[model samples]
Target: MADHLRDRFTAFFQKNVANPVMRRNPLQTLLETTGRKSGQPRRTPLGGSRVGNEFWFVSEFGDQSQYVKNIQANPRVRVRLRGRWHSGVAHLVPDDDPRRRLQSLPSFNSFGVRTFGTNLLTIRVDLDN
Candidate 1:
């Protein structure tokens, strides 16, 4: 019951508050996914690190996340890193340990993910050269 309520509350806060503010920030990393139903572009602020040609992040809500669902429909995506957009293919890495993975990411963001996240899942985006 608490988890359900927390999910609902966090989803509302993220969609209504945090995301809007973060999206407007030039420095915030963002993931762009094609909407499956609307056939439109959707951008979500994310916390991740770029390693070589791959960008790594974890979805706090895992498969229940709308962005993850969009990725399921289309793996092709874009990521804004350091104010530049990069085209990439998003991959869900269920085999990766999300908790462990978070330890290697940005501390502040990782802490939020650990606190508010109900279902942790790792996502990897391999950028095109």
Candidate 2:
């Protein structure tokens, strides 16, 4: 990653996404999903939190995220929450749910607003390991 882009994204994760309190705690979880076409695993680091017993994550890039689509068409996933990777599955928010309210919130980057892309895929996570 280029220095400038890396610095900017780091700022977003630190300031806007990752909680200040959780920074010191090993509470983060990363989801690594495979490309539906290639079958090879692609790891995309994300800031995750729990909603009840289920895990949740907001995509920084919305639906245009290849990994998001991949996981949508294929629910199985792999995760690395605390320096370890574990295989799991991911699912999208059903259109019928009231949780769809999240779509209205203004998206954010560390510096400013984030324009949503086509996929608009906001989904909950299910872990097997």
Candidate 3:
């Protein structure tokens, strides 16, 4: 089916291409959450914005995403923005309207989310100074 192909393609591209490129890009924003099982730090490239002391981003796979599951088990996290890392506590806002939130984010990123994202979930991270 279409979904199956999309899933396979997404997995391949993310592992072989997107992740590697994002890891090296200084401008790319990243989210770091603790691994739920391994208790190791896990980082993933993301597109988001910081408002005051909070950082916001939408997950394409919602609760099904590994990072979201990690956030659920441990709210503590860190975010790298503009090459500076900041510690934060993540909060999953299931009640927030992700589509509406996307409209307020950067255009290029938002377009990708709106186009490719299937199960959108909004997350807000409260930074610790």
Top-TM-score candidate index: 1
* Candidate models: Cα lDDT each: 0.97, 0.56, 0.89
24-112 per-residue lDDT for model 1 (tens digits): 99989999999999999999999999999999999999999999999999999999999999999999999999999999999999998
lDDT against true structure, model 2:
0.56
Top candidate on lDDT is 1
TM-score of each: 0.99, 0.55, 0.93
What's model 1's TM-score?
0.99
lDDT of 3 by residue, 1-129 (tens): 786677667767876899788979887899989999999998898898899999999997789788999999999999999999999999999999999999889888888778777789999999996
TM-score of 3: 0.93
When summed lDDT is taken over every stretch of 10 residues in candidate 1, the lowest stretch is 120-129
Alpha-carbon runs more than 4 Å astray in model 3: none
CA RMSD, predictions in order: 0.5, 7.7, 1.2
Could you arrange the candidates by lDDT from highest to lowest?
A: 1, 3, 2
Q: Which ten residues in a row are the worst by lDDT in model 3? A: 3-12
Q: Which 10 consecutive positions of candidate 2 have the poorest summed lDDT? A: 109-118
